[model samples]
Target: MSPGDGNDDDLYGGTGQTRTRLPDGGQGDMYGGAARRPARSSSRSLITVVGVVVLLVAAIAFANRGNSSSDDGDAKKPDTSPTAPTGTKAVTSGFAHDKQGAQSAAANYAVQLGSAEMFNKAQRDRILQEVITPSRVTGFEDTLDKAYSPEFNTNVGLNKDGSSPQGYTFVSRTTPIGTKATGYSASTANVAVWCSGLLGMAGENSKNPVTNSWFTISMKLEWTGGDWKIVTHSQKDGPAPVPGDERASSSDEIANAVEGYGGFTYAR
Candidate 1:
């Protein structure tokens, strides 16, 4: 269809074409020979443009109001420096002498508990004996032994000796976000460790793939055998964020990287 044909509907007004009589009074041509529209006065056009700009600005401001509220609400205000510890005075006072020491102990203990060594029976038993309460150490060892059985290792693509297969590299590493003492006494404290971890195998044709996990590990700690030891511990999933852009490393590279890296003894 030809644009603006008389047969076509006119979106703005009447017929697509208009006729105007000539001043001489003869038959007038359609559109008066491409009739020109009445020119808008400069003042009127300026007013129209100003009105449109005002409406656009108002609409943009309204749309941004909600965004401004969110920005203001989501931002945390800066905390004023504290004069001294204020809450739970009794619990704080009981462990006052050992606050720093306890935090350091819990952080280091968390790293060890989440290490790959926990998958090996001998190494695990030794760790438990060193880091767990005397009364609960045996029970914890037995439970962990049951948990890290041959079947479990096989499920994770690990050999019976708790080693990764020839071509597959098992990656299990925990990064601690922070640690807090929820309950503290002269002899006992409940420490919670927030952590993110990477676990699984990275290898061509590998059945298991590396995945990230966020979890909070809570440990019931006791001052036993002259040092802090874990009596019990539990884990729950996270406050996780969206994944980022990073290429996955190959199995051999992952294995070598883990071998080359050494774990740290954390302190707060």
Candidate 2:
């Protein structure tokens, strides 16, 4: 399907709340002036996170599979794990304080929770179930549902039911640039994720053309089950650099680009 947009955020009709571009603390531009740029973790939260990780282990399948046996060669498959240390399960557990697992989890969760799919009820529920502490899932659902109200949906040029506009593709993606731990403990860690995002709608004759943005997502993480889970989260604008004199892409081009390019899975 094709996409539509108007970089100016035409969907909100200028309300500037839908698709969340809510004002965050930072120095960067959204559409005009400003610089462009772009969490803590806890314990009961940890248990819940680890528990959820157990449920998703089979689904993620990132664990390293031992190399296949060879008939003549004896060259063992060198370490193939990406971004994980020795003896630690790949992306399933081992989110200890010193290992930076909490930081990685925060980076990955930022991508999932900030995705366009989070606007949909089913996907949102699943995400909350996986990344948020068990005790908070139901509450987060109710709170977030209210946050993405029907009016907010309409402002983003969607139907009141949160369905995409006909022939249009809405985009909301987040990419983590880096992570830093402000605090750590046996069961809790506080980390920061610097991020950039793409938001708005795509297609011909679209009012809100897709636009790029930068921000920071602050997450209060808890040590649940064993891994890190979000206890609270907040956002702020970017520490953006001055804009260059580059011409912006056409709406059609932007739409095509979004449709053609797939997003990354891991954040770090």
- Specify the highest-lDDT model's number: 2
| Per-model TM values vs. the true structure | 0.60, 0.66
On residues 177-227, what C-alpha lDDT tens digit does candidate 2 reach at each position? 889888878677777777666666566555554555555656667887766
Global Cα lDDT for candidate 1: 0.44
Q: Give all candidates' CA lDDT scores.
A: 0.44, 0.50
Writing each residue's lDDT as its tens digit, candidate 1 over 1-268 gives: 1011221111111121111111222132211223332221222111111110000000000000111122322223221211111111101111223645566566555555555556667756666566666776666655455556687567556797777787665655556688888888888887776766555555655545444455565666777655676665555445656655455455456555555554332323
> RMSDs, each prediction?
31.7, 13.0
Span of ten consecutive residues with least summed lDDT in model 2: 52-61
Give me the runs in candidate 2 sitting further than 4 Å from their true place: 1-99
True-vs-predicted CA distance for residue 215, candidate 1, Å: 0.8
Worst 10 residues of 1 by lDDT: 53-62
Identify the candidate with maximal TM-score.
Answer: 2
Give residue 120's lDDT in candidate 2 (0 to 100). 64
